[model samples]
Target: MNVVPDPITTQEQASKERENLLDFFARGLICTTARAVGADHGEPSEEALTKARAVADDYLAAYEEWLVKLTADNAAPGPQ
Candidate 1:
């Protein structure tokens, strides 16, 4: 009947996980952007740049939504 999980603790752990995922996603985006710009021709294809930017923007938007949800979830009562 002891050592049970608590709301604050669980929320903290979830937040940590979110931060970790965001870190990797952001790192990958940076690498992709670098590769897109550092082409051998010294010029990247417009299509490639567009695709890369679109993916990066989507990731950013998703991260923002996740952050908001995480905060809102932690604010809830009960076991969380």
Candidate 2:
């Protein structure tokens, strides 16, 4: 006989999956920035550096926004 999964366990698993995906994307952003700055024999051009900085800043802002939303969501009350 097959058993049904618990709702709480399912929710927790989904939450973990979301966190893992976010972490993966964050690492991707870091790697992209590193590649942009470390290109051309360990000396990227000024324009490349500037563009990389902008990209990094945007990524940071997005991360902060996500954190705020996550914090708010966690602080909210759940079902009784």
Candidate 3:
């Protein structure tokens, strides 16, 4: 028999899933960054490496902010 899911439970599950996905993406980004830097013979040029790091940092920061907002929204009470 099919069971009906509770709305709050469903929302919580969705939020958890999103967090897991974000974590996976963050790990993948780290691996990709390492490979990209390693592909250069010896160390990459300082300027290029610096730029790449800045971009990665910006993306991570934005993602963190987004996560915080999402968590807050989910935690807030809904309309009656």
Candidate 4:
């Protein structure tokens, strides 16, 4: 017999996938920033690394907000 996934389970799976994608993007952003910083100065200091992480966190937050707004706008019914 084939197993059927519940709606809630499907939503959960999608949420997990979105989180994973966000995390992957955030890490890549951090690494790229760190590499650029390191290239300029042999190695980045702890403070610099901390700042990079903070920036990444801020970026993710802003990105999430933008996505929410975009989704909401798209979901709204278009003018007749």
Give the Cα-based TM-score of candidate 2 against the true structure: 0.46
Question: CA lDDT, every prediction?
Answer: 0.67, 0.64, 0.65, 0.68
TM-score for each candidate, following the candidate numbering: 0.42, 0.46, 0.44, 0.46
> In model 4, which runs have C-alpha deviations exceeding 4 angstroms?
1-47
Cand. 3 TM to true fold: 0.44
- Clash counts for the predictions, in order: 0, 0, 0, 0
Query: Each candidate: RMSD to true structure?
Result: 10.5, 10.8, 10.1, 7.2
> Which tens-of-lDDT digit does each residue in 45-80 have in candidate 1?
566555555665678778789999999999999897
By TM-score rank, best first, the candidates go: 4, 2, 3, 1
**Which 10-residue window of candidate 4 scores lowest in summed lDDT?**
39-48
Error of 2 at 11 (Å): 35
lDDT of 4: 0.68
What is residue 4's positional error in candidate 3, in angstroms? 32
Best by lDDT: 4
lDDT of 3 at 51: 60
Q: List ranges where model 3 is wrong by over 4 Å.
A: 1-42
Candidate 3 local Cα displacement, residue 68, angstroms: 0.6
